[model samples]
Target: MIKNIIFDFGDVFINLDKPATVNQLSKLDSSFCVSGKMNEINEAYEKGLIATDAFVSFYKSKFPAINEASLINAWNAIILDLPEYRLSFLEQLANEKKYRLFLLSNTNELHIEHVINTCGSDTFNRFKDCFEKFYLSYEIRYRKPDPEIYKYVLSENKLNPEETLFIDDVKENTDAASALRIKTWNLKPGIDDVTMLKDQTCFG
Candidate 1:
């Protein structure tokens, strides 16, 4: 029986415009789209190895033609508007108390700051209140696809791996959780909805 539900924030709950980010950056630095520098920079930033200011400054230096504001905007272009339907679904899930709910995301400071700004402080707070624990990669010093992070969450919550349902849009993250024997949902962005699980008798 799945007694715990773990969710990934981006794409699972919020949408991301991956291509737009690459396209915008490519216009400034032709290398960004071809090379994996953007992904490398983001990985470094998400792990807290690089500070937000430092990352932005580094990006600005690399792409001199683009101004700081536009560069920053492009970096944050992955973030998309939160839907009210998702919010309502989360609220309902919390109220039911049918399962222990958790949120885990590989996010950095700038992305979070922009999410707070775009979603409104009140909405962010409300969303957070729905979770028993909200785990962030930067705060936790560990990111997904790393088994240690999943183990840490399970150990911290005292949850049995078999009793947990891990939901993420990324395949690698779910693969890590499955390796630990936790049930997982590798949701397709823009196509799958997390709330659909609530209707499935197999979920809870």
Candidate 2:
């Protein structure tokens, strides 16, 4: 009996070109890989441990040839379209009020800004209004696959792990949630659409 639903924003709802940023950056620096100090800096930024300007500055310092605009564009290139059908499904779910709905996403400021700018304020607001609690990684200073963040969400909402279902595109994230006794759907991007929730037995 699932009484609450937790969702991942990317892939599960909004589409993302997960490899676009890497590809774009690789063009700028042939040896650029998501490793070493870069990964640490990204984690720090996602955790809201650093400001947006600091993040941009760090990249600027590393890739002097790349201008701020180019860096920002490459960083945000991963964000793509948010299909209307998904939004419609979410809006319907919200209206039904059958269960507590929440959004937990590992996102940064620039990406969020891109989403707002691309999706338009009214559409974005509609999507936001669907959630009872919207947890942004940067804003919350917590991220997925970190058990503490899941614990915090459960504790704050007074939700029972047994009665909650978390849906995410990442297996690692879903695995972490499952470790806490929360049911999860590790949805495959192309094969599993969020709009097809009724097909999932957990929801049934």
Candidate 3:
């Protein structure tokens, strides 16, 4: 029986349009995509290899012609607001205490700041209180697709791997967790809904 559930924060919970940000950045500077600077900056930012300020500085330095405000806007274009229905679902699950719920996201400070601003501090706080443990890659210094991150969660919680269900939008992240014998759900966009999880027998 699944005794724990791991939720992914991005597309699995809050909708994120990856291409929208890339397209916006491309509009800011055609050279961003052409020069491959955007990819370099994002890779460094997401991996926690660079601080938010340093990441912004690196982008600004590369595109010295572009203003800092525009660069900041382009960088922050990824985050979208959290819907109310999803928030209610999470609240219900937490109240029920159906399983030990945890949230694991491969996120950074800037993106989180954007999320907080978009979702509002009160709502974000309410959402946060629902989880037994919350894990963010930047804060933890360990990212998804890295086995160590999953291992860290399991070890920190003292959870039995076989009794835990890990859900994520990305296949690679779930695959990593599954390797450790954790039951996983690779939530597909528009295909999987967290609220619908209650109807499934797989989860207790």
Candidate 4:
């Protein structure tokens, strides 16, 4: 029986245009591609190994033509809408207290700031209230698909892997969780809305 539920915050909850940043950056430089040291810098930033100022400075230095605001905008373009229905569903689930609910997300500072600005503090706080534990990659200094992170969640919460269900949009992330004996739902964005989670037999 599943006693705990872990959810990915990106596509599983908030709508994200995963390719928007890449496409947007390419417009600034036709030859722009996330490569070499760029990938390293991004990983470090995501892991909270670097400060936001350093991250912005690196991009500004690389793309001198792009102003700080423009660069931040392009970087944050991937974040999109968070539907009310999904929030409602989560709230209902939380109130029921049938499962231990947690949120695990691989996110950075700028994107989180964008979410707060776009979603407003009250709305975001309500959403956050629905989870027992909220794990942000940068804050936690750990990310998904890294077994250690999953281990940390389980160990910290004293959760049994066999009694936990991990839900994420990325197959690789779900796969990693599965390796640790956790059940998972690799939800498809358009077709598998989280509001319809009850339809899945696994929840039953």
Counting clashing residue pairs in each candidate, in order, gives 0, 0, 0, 0
**Cα lDDT of all candidates, in order?**
0.87, 0.93, 0.84, 0.92
| Regions of model 3 farther than 4 Å from truth | 34-41, 200-204
For candidate 1, the clash count comes to: 0
Cα lDDT tens digits for candidate 4, 46-161: 88999999999999899898889888989999999888989989999999999999999998999999998888889899899999999999999998889999999999999999
lDDT of 3 by residue, 32-87 (tens): 66357766666667778888889888877877888888877776787777989999
Q: Residue 26 deviation, candidate 3, in Å?
A: 1.0
Worst 10 residues of 2 by lDDT: 29-38
Q: Lowest summed lDDT over 10 consecutive residues: which window, candidate 3?
A: 32-41
TM-scores, one per candidate: 0.93, 0.97, 0.93, 0.97
Which of candidates 3 and 4 is the stronger one according to TM-score? 4
Give the TM-score (vs. native) of candidate 1. 0.93
Error of 2 at 63 (Å): 0.7
lDDT tens per residue, model 1, 1-204: 989999999988877887878788887777764448867877888988888888988877777788999988887898998888999999998999989999999999988989999999999998999999999898887899899999999999999999999999899999999999999988887677887876655475
> In terms of TM-score, how similar is model 4 to the real structure?
0.97
